[model samples]
Target chain A: MYICLMYSKEIVKGTLKPIVLKLLKEHGRMYGYEITQNVKALTEGKIQITEGALYPLLHKLQAEGVLQTESEKMGKRVRKYYKLSQSGEAVADDLISEMLDFMQTLKSVLNPDYGQA
Target chain B: MYICLMYSKEIVKGTLKPIVLKLLKEHGRMYGYEITQNVKALTEGKIQITEGALYPLLHKLQAEGVLQTESEKMGKRVRKYYKLSQSGEAVADDLISEMLDFMQTLKSVLNPDYGQA
Candidate 1:
């Protein structure tokens, strides 16, 4: 089995929102760059959250009231941090549960003996 | 945690291709309705593959040369069965491996202690 370190863009794209929400929930607040770096470090470079996918998702979450942003002055640049809103906290919980269930379904589909006794 | 019996359509949509490919690889060939019923039965009704999503995927796979269709006549109806082509066998292996890796990534994201000893 050839298990590559890098994942296909489509697979990463589908899971991006829940991944972002979960990361923010765990760490409280994170900027865009930090989220990307954290994901890369945690996945050991198996997954890379690209700017094209991350920024738009953050903006969409903000527009949907699931995330709120705060800006801080860092030397000569402004760093924007994202945190889950009250409703977003609820959404994060739901997304985590949903993803977990989805993973189980994937397991059963891939491995016939996954849930078999 | 409300783990509903039905998964969100979006999650199912993202995973449909690999699921279909794997099923075809495992069972040799299957028709549209049979595929849906097998998934429902295997997942214990947790996931449902809808026609709206399944047909277009089958057609796309056929057009892409990954799947070949055979029409068999049974009484008053002609049932179309799908089987993986030669290239599709290789693709199926790749997809299964990719899905497994992707599930591992999801595990690490959803559970921080996943890869920790």
Candidate 2:
């Protein structure tokens, strides 16, 4: 559960939920370990989600009905895979769109030449 | 201090500090009201910073030695303009760079195709 990167932890924390939702949207369904590995691979080891951080959020999302899980037997331990629920699909699209729009606004704030008066 | 937009309050809250720092970096120095007006105009009113949120952060940054303030009199009222201090300039650059990098990473997370395997 180590985050070895140039970015600060707080900033990464804010986007975790959205990142997970986006990954699930693209991948269909993913187990906890698969999620961690994919994030590492996707960011090229720049951003690593710790089990300490990931599991609680996954459980919380499941509790909130935003995520639905299915369990399968692997060896002896059960592997829980997560995907978005019906309502969660709508929530994910809305959140992703809002995040994209917010990013555009942030770009405008950073580069005032495009920001107009 | 109304944030009447599609974006959630929590999402906007996370970026306020960086947004303020980027503005001070771009505009040189700005007063509280001016900062709010610029953000409103820049985002085309999609994002607005409330006095309640802005003042506390300004004070906190000032206390942390990341910002220095100048007071100018406008008739009966004194307006305080904030700019980065000597050390603050460094901090501002660092924060701005980190924010931009984080945005790129967020984009990668949102779009898996560009994220590479």
Candidate 3:
């Protein structure tokens, strides 16, 4: 119960782009379904992200100039792939660092007694 | 140069609320502007989140029923305090666990060689 009311997928959805963009920035490019599959494989099913959440974040990231998308013919449906823009690459690095710091700060606040210096 | 394009504040802005909500879920009621100041203080300016980004996120969180708000008189202006709803509390816990797992998966893929067992 203590942990039950602590986080939201909507918030996760909002932030997933930096995670995806950062990965793509290093790997060059990746596809929609592929991105979802990769995340699932990496987390081993503990952190399953639905297509509904991912696609919208991808679209929004692409629209925000932080991500670039290209299309490829894949059987019947066209597969859309995404990569980071020059600006996006810069942003991803900053994001990872900031998030790391943010996590620490949260840990300290949430466990202040033991978290003390 | 390589790190220049790894993160985007806009993307960060979108996800700030889940973190904020998680904090609020633990802290109970907190103010609008106070939220921004606290995040800044916590991150040591490395994660200086602006009021523009925070207020919108807070408003949206409130709208989504992940947050509840009440107004209080403060000098010349009224300050709004936000807390988690029954549903919002449940969401925060899930978000934190999911995000933690995500961070680990991301670390592995980004650093594949050392990441392997």
Candidate 4:
């Protein structure tokens, strides 16, 4: 099961930061589980953002000042929600643009019909 | 100059293997310099594959049995050209498919009009 996911994992790892930022931008704020579930649902179970990969990225974004977190008590447990900071919003936009450009380049490369090579 | 390329480098680093494989699949055999130039030309100088990044990946692919190399003397210098092996061809196909799927997922995520949240 896990072995089958190697390719997806590699692709996701590269785009994870932008994906998280884009989600945060759209939703305003999202907790870890919500983020993971949203991604799973959006990708139709083809891509799963595991806790192991998600937490460190969240932490890294927080460290980089691209994300801010708010913790709210949900009964006995605390739910930490993440949202993009001002700089994060700018970063998200830049990331999306960069990703789009990259996809375009890749599309040209992948589709020889484009005759780019 | 180098700083302007940070985003592009990050994106390219993630997709380099597939890009290289695709290029090899199309061209049959290519030397390191030729591969680098091809990528630079294809991306319109937006992405540059530095020697530092390209060599290790090529070696890794060869070690994984996904690439085979042939050395020929071009004047006084020996030029190494790489091509996909049998397993390499299969891997290249899988990688291209995976990359395409990834781009689709990214397109949906990046496009707010998609309402994919």
Candidate 5:
């Protein structure tokens, strides 16, 4: 059976980080679950960030000093909220710019009529 | 000193296969150097495909039956050409659609104002 997906896993994999960063840029300080829900709702379930993928990337971004986190007591568990650090804000801006430019380039490559090439 | 690049290596890395596939779809069979030059010209030198990256991807796609290659003797050396296989055409079409959709999703993520979100 051929199952149609709105987007491919490969495309999703490459863009996950930027998606997270941009969401945080738009809506400041989001908890992990909030991030997931926000993305799900925003993309209409076309783009779901698995916990396996999201947490590690969050951790890595934190480790790289690009992200900051704070925890609040939520009943028996601590709920962590994440936000971009100042450096992360800069990184996000740079990445967003790069991503947009890359999209234009890819569009040109796919549809040469769209470009001067 | 921060040197601005037209696109990041990471973005280029992820899109390379689709770029190659799309070019072949537009221009028919192409050899390795020709592919590189076509990308260079098309992207206006913004997206250069390094041999180290391009060859491995070509070989991998060939192995996966997504691409077919034909080699011709060029005097002292043999020149190899690549095109989408019959199945590869379908794959390329699917990927191009997915990539375009993913680009829209990514644009929405980056610029929520543009989306219904």
Candidate 6:
């Protein structure tokens, strides 16, 4: 039985950071599972951030100074919560603003009814 | 010139590639000047992507197989045109869909009026 998987690797490579940064930017802080669940809920099961992809992104974010981690004991497992760093907050604002602008530009180009490109 | 700039480096570092990818994802293909001009037009002068940064990203995207380039001679400049590669198209779809989902998740967390985080 071939279980056709949906999320492709190339997509993950390109978008992992922005998605993760955007998450930390808004939520203040969240554990690994929480991030995954948030993505699942928002995407309505159409999109998911796998552990393999999510953890590495968290680590990279920490390395880049865009994220920080705190430990919280949740029952048995001590979960590491990811949050935005001081620099991360500034980044979030810039990213969100730029993206919104990009969306408008894209709408103009991709869906010409929005605006003439 | 104590020209206080709006686009901070941290913001640029965090958002550079996604913004570029998002741009290429929407517009079929465009050159360096066009990309800068496109960003300017959409941003209404609020955001500007410099050539130093833009070229490196275009080169990196090409390296990553998410973009392919063709040369177009316009007046004195032989501009390189970037389009989604075979994988880039799949990557773009996945990136766009995933980002929209992430945006919803972020709205719930940041805005709260959208949904519960």
Q: With candidate 4 superimposed using the best TM-score fit, by how many Å does residue B61's alpha carbon deviate from the native?
A: 1.5
- The candidate that wins on DockQ is 1
**TM agreement with the true structure for every prediction:** 0.93, 0.87, 0.57, 0.89, 0.90, 0.51
Q: Which candidate wins on lDDT?
A: 1
In model 6, where do residues sit more than 4 Å from their true spots? A1-13, A115-117, B1-117
Residue range A33-98, candidate 3, lDDT tens digits: 888777667656544667887888888878899889889897998988898888988867667555
Higher-scoring candidate on lDDT, 2 or 3: 2
CAPRI-wise, candidate 1 is medium
Candidate 3 Cα outliers beyond 4 Å, as residue runs: A1-40, A45-117, B1-13, B113-117
The regions of model 4 sitting more than 4 angstroms off are A1-7, A114-117, B1-6, B112-117
Return whichever of 4 and 5 wins on TM-score: 5
Q: Can you list the residue pairs that collide in candidate 2?
A: none
True contact recovery of candidate 1: 0.57
Per-residue CA lDDT of model 5 for A11-50, tens digit only, reads 6767888889998988889999999999999888889889
Ranking by lDDT: 1, 5, 4, 2, 3, 6
Per-residue lDDT tens digits for candidate 1, residues A1-117, read 557878887666588888889899999999999999999998889889989989999999999999999999999999999999999999999988898878877888887775232
B1-117 in candidate 1: lDDT tens per residue? 557878887666578888899899999999999999999998889889889989999999999999999999999999999999999999888988888778877788788775232
Against the unseen true structure, what C-alpha lDDT does each candidate score?
0.87, 0.82, 0.65, 0.82, 0.84, 0.65
Better of 3 and 6 by DockQ: 3
Output the TM-score of candidate 2.
0.87
lDDT of 2 by residue, B1-117 (tens): 223354677567578888899889888999999999999987878888999999999999999999999999999999999999989988887776777677777776786465333
lDDT of 4 at B83: 99
Q: Assign candidate 6 its CAPRI class.
A: incorrect
What are the runs in model 5 whose C-alpha is more than 4 Å off? A1-4, A115-117, B1-4, B115-117
Error of 2 at A76 (Å): 1.7
